[model samples]
Target: MPDSAPPPEFGEASHEPTEALEPSAADLSRTRTEEAVPHTAIIVPILARGVTLGVTTFFRSRRDEAFDEDDLRLAEELVARAAVCLDNARRYTRERAAALVLQRSLLPHGVPPQEAVEAASFYRPADELSGLGGDWFDVIPLSGARVALVVGEVLGHGIEAAATMGQLRTAVRTLADLDLSPEELLAHLDDLVIQVTQEGHEADPGGVSGPGAVGASCLYAVYDPVGLRCELASAGHLAPAVVTPDGTVAFPDLPPGPALGLGGLPFESVDLPLEEGSVLAFYTDGLIAAPGAGKEGLRRALTERELPLDQLCRRIVDELAPSRPYTDDAALLMVRTRRLAASHVAAWDLPADPAVVARARLMAARQLGTWGLEELAFTTELVVSELVTNAIRHAAGPIRLRLILERTLICEVFDASSTSPHLRHARTTDEGGRGLFLISQFTRRWGTRYTAEGKVIWAEQPLDPDDTPARTSGD
Candidate 1:
């Protein structure tokens, strides 16, 4: 097309003049100017899946020859390929954002405060290209002044892995509430994963299942401040690192049970006796997998155990995986062990006789006086009396009474039988069923926990009456 020709209007047709008209002087001047700088342009629509994303305009100026059919075909082909790439990029960005949001929302915002372990955590998502993986960590406060620490990782990345991580984390918390042993908790988690895998296979027989469809690894550890011990079990996870108060680091040889979803192997728990102020480090494999990071580097990072856990967590990440946008998701949880002083705990074995209930109450009252908690002696004595009488009446074998003085006073009664106790509303005429009800009215919270030897019925009473209004009972 000649540069002198006028551009056609959109949705308008061009018609040839019936007769030629002489050009005006102004028109002749315009034509001469246009001829001096000749230009042509072609526009091609960028299409993906038969939908036009946009248009690419190719312009040629001062060209001796105009664009031909071959040029148009080449432009169309190039734009078609570019369109597909752009569409893919757009889709990936959306999915990556959604996955990140889901993962963050599902993870714990902050670790809850507890008496057993002082903990801090760190989490880093994978680089954009790799997407996010299923790495998670949590610190759960268990009954009997204990705490459970968990670290887990699913096999793949993106939304599927994140969803799997959330499910497994929830399962761990539920099992922790039951106060299951580390080995028992892992066994239950393994069964859960196997069930999920079977369901996924049944749903999609031909295609690969979800990110964790094959398997995942986890470490579950429970720390008892009273016992000064940590019981830990792993499901194909790396062993945890323990740094003693004297600055010695060691990774205990933990039995590596089969990963979750692999059903036959038995999980075993190892009891690690930890000293007061010892630092325990739990992390996913990504920390060591990073470049220039390994067990030695981690040990070096953890040597200064006196530093606050929050700062120490950052230091570990900076030393191990300093660069941003990690290739894989990384999680770290560190806890400093704390021991309950022996002076705050009192325990005694009582014979299973109705006559001993009064003696048990007297023992608890005297312990309260020794702890200078005489104001709480009245309620504490009542709690001890009712729990002892119930155990003596309903359960079998020897009964033991224990009083623990902390922020609140804890009274516990242990009996050999595993039969759980139930809280009942006693009718006015009933004399026997009123003991548990009276105990509940006198305590802030109460629950039962089963140990290897027997079950313990524990009640917590507020040390200060003013603190009662701010607290909620967990009966």
Candidate 2:
């Protein structure tokens, strides 16, 4: 071959024999002595969509017959077929790499520390058959020392599924922030999926496309450490496996609602008490979908409690998957519950009167001193006085003040009114509207939440002594 020669066009073949060919740098491997040289050879350039990738060469030994046009045509046909496959292989490699990066970015990088439960998760994408199947898990920290465990799997694979998984995960977090129960959260998520499906159908008027829009299963649970209880709801997902502290394995019979995007059916939520040190496993179907073994096998595997939660998750995955690479994505999230003891909390009911404000302030100071948070006592006392005064002045009777010692010092005032308190700025002459304003200035954060009984105004102050204000009314 010579550099001056134009590259071969489509359906063209070039033939060269050892006697006519001029030696080149790349042809050094083929160069041989006259007695050892081949009689003739055929070269066919592999073309994919008008682009030449490489050439296929065939050689004949000294005794073999000379290569002819018929042989060259056959060689061209074979290379043409190989070219298509080579092109597809290249495309698939590029897409898989992009999908892997997208999947990793969408998933949670690390679980943040929470006071209610210890969580660990493992995710393995189906790298071979399914190119980036959508399987994801997350540990969301909620208010009141509670944490939400989530696991979801989008039905199809590739970039579409990964994108949908991310969308659903984001929706779940937004709903969780609203302090919605598991049942209510999924209901909202189902509606969101319905909207997405409609948009997909409109985008492709002919029919459904792109992972079939909202074909996915999700399991959501919120665990409360105060009561050691977990409320669970599922949307066409497998029941979670719960291993008790005493080694009892049970998959609470939770109602499996219809998968998301199906509007006819309603979802159900169940509440179960999980004692301290109990192991709760939330996973997708891929984890337990062995050839013959199913959820029963998963239950058996989860019964072993000697290993740590992180180690247990890996062991379960290794045991259930076959020797061959996975055909579907798998994700497992394990949570070990830890309850706050009675000593960590203090509560008292006070009459709706101005006199009780003094008593509430004393109680807050005493509790803070007991918990070695004396430095926060000045601000805590001011917050307690303001909240109690507001409850007695504007709200109904049966007011309650509770103090919780956890990662922070939380003071909550429960009243029998549903009115939401907002932080309003008061002018220097405004005498009555400054209660909440004063409380906000003294605490790190404050908010109000409604309960079945009434609304509770809560404020959180940093436990670190350095975070406490240097000057106070008491000072």
Candidate 3:
């Protein structure tokens, strides 16, 4: 018999005998015992598509009837249907596992320490049956003693959603490096989402097409320790909960911009001045939408701001979302605001004259000496001279030179002109256009940021030369 075929009855003839032999006494006794115990068994292979997953065996005994052809056919049909269901479940399990791994790998494993805020984060994926949802959060350090906090969510679930989440997270970081304001960053992100949707539609014209194909929401906030203020903008995301040092909880009303991928909507940013040690809780909607926890519950959870940031994050999640499987993914980032010490920051107003550049250098050298960074004076002075000279020559009005002492030494030159400086490679005969270039080479990193009064050209120098490697001017 074939592997898929049922076994024949015991003591049944393999073929019809040409001449039947008379039954002996022992054979007759055996037949009588077999007849006394009437039993039958049928085996059916569980086949899905063209492959057999397993076999099901049905046994019947002590009955006048046995399993016939009709019974075997019914058994095979039932097992085949069950096998298809099992295969689908298996495929789903595999896909979910892959998506979870991809999502976790893409998320930040650790947040580095920065001067602006002490931050901690939490992320939990959705339940097994629901698969993983695309919810992510990050703390990115920016130039000039500032930090960017981000929390975003992509609609839908599975591997595609996780991939989209990673893409958005990376784009946010890249945009943050340019020192864009929160509103400006979201607007750029909106354009990117629209472009991605258009490309996706082109790839699959017959498939479902719309903003829903790439619909997402995000909240980007920049915290400036020097200014002691935070500028926040949202793309159809929830407002963060603010908890003061005195345990007062308040949610700042933010302009709810349209969700990403929807074109032609402008995003506005709100600048909030926070007191020292105030706690800002940034989270996705899943945290508040959990069972038994809503906006009120989130407020209640945030009351215990006295706890350490890491502990506070855990406490809030435990109180609201918990460790149990949720229908949606949840993410939380809690940061305590801090102020840059007055002693660490030094600024001076300089007249737009070549003579003032020497005084500016002297002031910076003296400040570095006071801060015990004398080793970096030579490079600092050169950077200061180049930035100030450029500002004096090209920019209008009085110039302001500011130096901030943190993990790195930051030199900033502010002017009333909005035109940003460009770094150009000068020929052997050229005299000008080398100021910004030389600044870029001498400093660890340098960039320009626009201010309301004008524009500020800033450069960062490493505090310890031996520990930090210098990068090329292109960097």
Candidate 4:
């Protein structure tokens, strides 16, 4: 108990000293003993979003010169307080890691080098007890004709929230891959969260590392290549902001539902017009939710119609912050839409000639290439080939292929025949029935919509900036 007795090794819990992170007994002894043991001190760093908030530490020591049962008890009690600190620090670390990883791994590294349109982004982690809050935003290029945009948040903060955010994100990516409808994907994710929570799954969710859990609020949309329209869905998240051609910010009215994991049905995706020279901003609530953000703050700072997207992001991060770096997590995503060099069109025809098809191919390629949209071109051609062929062969009268790119490549074959194309499994040797099959195989998404001007068949594929080796059914 005498100060003369050499300080012990760094034990597991206490500074009792087993193996200090330091070197040797001589060095340990050489170090000031007062520096070694003192009263006790505990520190907690607030983590919000994914950034460090501030550190909170407490100091205490053995009442007696040496830690006795009562002193140990005090240490334990101190630990209880420190637990809050440690837990917060650990949460901040994990959440910060999760957010940074997600931000880097999930978001498009940067706009395509030579894109026709300009794009940029900004990120800020919440500063809080454990910046593990779950706000997230992401963008994925879909088939050359379209791109997928997402913004969402898992409930709560810490490892659980990050994990949940990751899970929902994965679900979005997977469902997007499956080419399922946005509505279907939301439903699927809802089911998944419930299943994981009530039961649990091996798959990790959001930023959480281990078997995943938690739930989220999400919005996923597809931006078309040609028309540049957006098809979006809301799941207990804030309504999106659209900066129009004339500098008008429009916020869609989102319907009601609990955030994911609270338990319920999936929210459906809705379609919106995405015009040229337009900017759309999607963000988690943390960006807009201060104690008094209300709608006015968002309208003025983050979602003002005339504001540039980069400016919007900066403003959101600047204004409306709680005391902590994250108090809760936060995320922001923005995109600017540019018009094609020239409008792409299906020329009127007297006959369904090979020349027409050639023209269509040339049109699609030129627009895609000029727009720096290599990803949607190949599939667009493939789709054009299938639809035009179908129009010429199966239906009578003038066949027209008009491209209405929103969420999918809507290929309309204005055939006299009112017959709808059906998706079917093909036989190995069969060539004729393979038209729709090829479209199905090549694209991540596909479907049809009946318009006044005949029927349209559409498909979606992962938008790629480069023509990397494509994945097959097996891949």
Best by TM-score: 3
| Deviation in Å, model 4, residue 74 alpha carbon | 18
Kindly list the per-residue Cα lDDT of model 3 for residues 135-173, writing each as its tens digit. 889999888889999999988766667778888999999
Clashes of 4: 47
- Model 4 stretches with alpha carbons more than 4 Å out: 1-119, 127-131, 178-181, 201-215, 261-269, 302-308, 344-386, 390-469, 472-475
Clashes of each: 0, 0, 0, 47
Cα RMSDs, all models: 5.9, 5.9, 5.8, 10.5
List TM-scores for all candidates, in order.
0.77, 0.78, 0.81, 0.58
Residue 183's lDDT in candidate 4: 65
Error (Å) of candidate 4 at residue 150 is 1.1
Which candidate do you rate higher for lDDT, 2 or 4?
2
lDDT at 227, model 1: 88
The regions of model 2 sitting more than 4 angstroms off are 1-90, 128-131, 199-204, 211-215, 323-327, 425-445, 465-475
Model 3: number of backbone collisions? 0
lDDT against the true structure, per candidate, is 0.80, 0.80, 0.82, 0.60
Q: After best superposition, candidate 4 residue 392: deviation in angstroms? A: 6.6
lDDT of 4 by residue, 22-51 (tens): 234454454445455333333334434444
**Per-residue lDDT for 1-475 in model 1, tens only?**
2234485453222222211222345545665667533244667776677666777777654444556768777777787789899889877778777776787787888878678888889887675454466889999987677789999988877777888888999999988877788999999999988888778778988985654744799999999899899999999998989999999999999998999988898999999999998999999888888776888888888887666889999788767886776767788998889999999889999999999988888888888889888888888877888888889878999999988776677788999988888888888898678767777777777778787998988887777855643232333
How does model 3 fare in lDDT?
0.82
